[model samples]
Target: MNKTGKIYVVGIGPGSKEHMTFEAKTAIEKSDIIVGYKTYIDLIKDMLEDKEVASSGMKKEIERCTEALEYAKQGKTVSLVSSGDSGVYGMAGIMFEVAFKDESHVEVEVIPGVTAANAAAASLGAPIMHDYVTISLSDLLTDWSLIEKRLHCAGKGDFVVCLYNPKSKGRQQQIQIAREILLKYKNEDTVVGIVRNAKRAGESIVITTLGDMLKYEIDMFTTVIVGNSNTYSVKEKMITPRGYEL
Candidate 1:
């Protein structure tokens, strides 16, 4: 609550009212204006119908934040909501870049929410409890070569890899390519968990080995968790539980 104005870059979690955190709910309830992508706004439409709302299309990340800033300049409490935790492949970083680049903006605070990583982990049963790393499969901003390099490194390091944006129409094979890269260091029997629409109404969680991954079709709503050598599956659940017994 600073004089420059206040912007709450809020994360709404994975498209579910029950999964949304209390703090995130409180922030949304208190906000004077809610700005976000159209689908996300529609997801929480009932709670925000009375509030001033502004929504953008799928590919308008910067424009969305800029529009939120304009609302902030008017001394309105603006909430720029993201689908998952703002820090993890969400809108927080971009909003920060916009604020810093422009300068002289409102107080931007990122209120955290359950990300796909957390949701996927929960769905599949603690596959990232120990040392792990997260990577995004989208090559829109990053080069696929760099993604391959990182995938190789993560595989070599035996880190549990949480992957975001695993599959879309344009980049369907990116995850398959990453699986091939990881297979070099891992095994054909290495456990992998695919959680689609995690925590949402139509959520589905699948646990299979690396060899079976090609048979499964993923989407943008899916978050893929590929286990390390130490990880395994039990009763069809991919688990990387803390090594307490060992």
Candidate 2:
């Protein structure tokens, strides 16, 4: 009987090698095979020279995870990569589900990396310093009604909101609708920070008001941080104060 090899779910972090956790880097180096979405694989092409790579396009997550598990079962160390922390809207959960369904005994390890919220917030000067909620606008798997409910709750709770997968070619209307929902609770002047391609190439940061945010360019790579009532902008930076007295 061949010994099963381990699988590592790695988060590459915001398309920048510097943002990747040391553990994540080490896992990729140790893996005999690297599997991930094509975009994520391209982000780390420098590290994949000697490794066997299997990359596919969007919406093929199940196929990627299954392939990684298969390689692991064949006694090959496998690294399954995601752009952000794998557990947060990444491949870690799906990988676990696949492994469990197959009743496979291969060991699995998850390495965390800086997620988009963290990277975008840092680039915009701590817009998430207070309590925050992260939501993905993509409704590919999740129903749009469920996502709308989450947006309403996040808005009513006065929580700093971080939006992922904000807008794409076919998904342009969701963000617009989200703004309207958030406006019911937040002030029109509430500080909003938009970070595109955070911590990566062609990064752009814009600090605007909730009412004015829509005027800026936003897309799938952009992270939109809508501040709570108390959050404010200063010196071109968006900040949500933690209520510490000066």
Candidate 3:
């Protein structure tokens, strides 16, 4: 315990031990306290035996980061965990912002992990091999109008689009609207990949087309990939070729 304890923002990937990176494991092992969402904390609970753990449900992100920083200020090594890459809609950025705003002097390190888009893509097929954009269909923090503009732009550019938080129990129409917007600019038969619970238990992947995407059930766990104009399916594998000739 010293005045200069360090904080590690670690990405744990999908809620599975297999997908958790070695760097994340090491950082957690070296930390004196663990802080993350309740679900993500449970993912590595076995490895955290006898360690101090602080977990909370959704909307507690700022509280969680603040607690971790306080623990670090007390000369404790802290691990702030996030699902997927910490920089991608995860805790790293938030932690840094809070640290800078508070003018804390603790060192910070970010460890990257496999993202939902990559994990889901591996399960379904390669739909983002070319120019692509990653967007979250949820309108919680972002305005719906802005999201719609981006969706329409992605469609116009024929960019392979990776969608996060496609749908949930309360908000089911965002993805449906996204599907409709893309349909206007892309072919009705454009390929779309749906993956639920990527890299975790009961994982499911479906390769369908733009016209039929709305028929499938989706939730926060699902990651949807809308293929570009050149994307196609070969033997159930959605491949977006990078212009390589055989």
- lDDT score for residue 205 of model 1: 82
For TM-score, the strongest prediction is: 2
TM-score of each: 0.95, 0.99, 0.97
User: Across residues 105-213, which tens digit of lDDT does each residue of candidate 2 receive?
Assistant: 9999999989999999999998888899999999999999999999999999999999999999999999999999999999899999999999999999999999999
Clashes per candidate (backbone, < 3 Å): 0, 0, 0
Clashing pairs in 2: none
Candidate with the larger lDDT of 1 and 3: 3
> Candidate 3 residues 1-246, lDDT tens each?
467778999999986779888899999999999999999998889989989999999989999999999999999999999999999989999999999999999899999998999899888777778889999998888999999999999999899999999998889789989999999999989999999988988999889999998888789989999999899998889999889899
What ordering of candidates by TM-score runs from best to worst?
2, 3, 1
- Which numbered prediction scores highest in lDDT against the true structure? 2
Q: Rate the local accuracy (lDDT) of all candidates.
A: 0.88, 0.94, 0.91
Model 2 stretches with alpha carbons more than 4 Å out: none
In candidate 3, stretches whose alpha carbon ends up further than 4 angstroms from where it belongs are: none
lDDT of 1 by residue, 107-198 (tens): 89999999889998998987998999999999999998899999999999999999999989888789889988999999999899999989
Q: What C-alpha lDDT, on a 0 to 100 scale, does residue 99 get in candidate 2?
A: 98
Residue 14 C-alpha lDDT in model 2:
90
Instruction: Give the candidate order by descending lDDT.
Output: 2, 3, 1
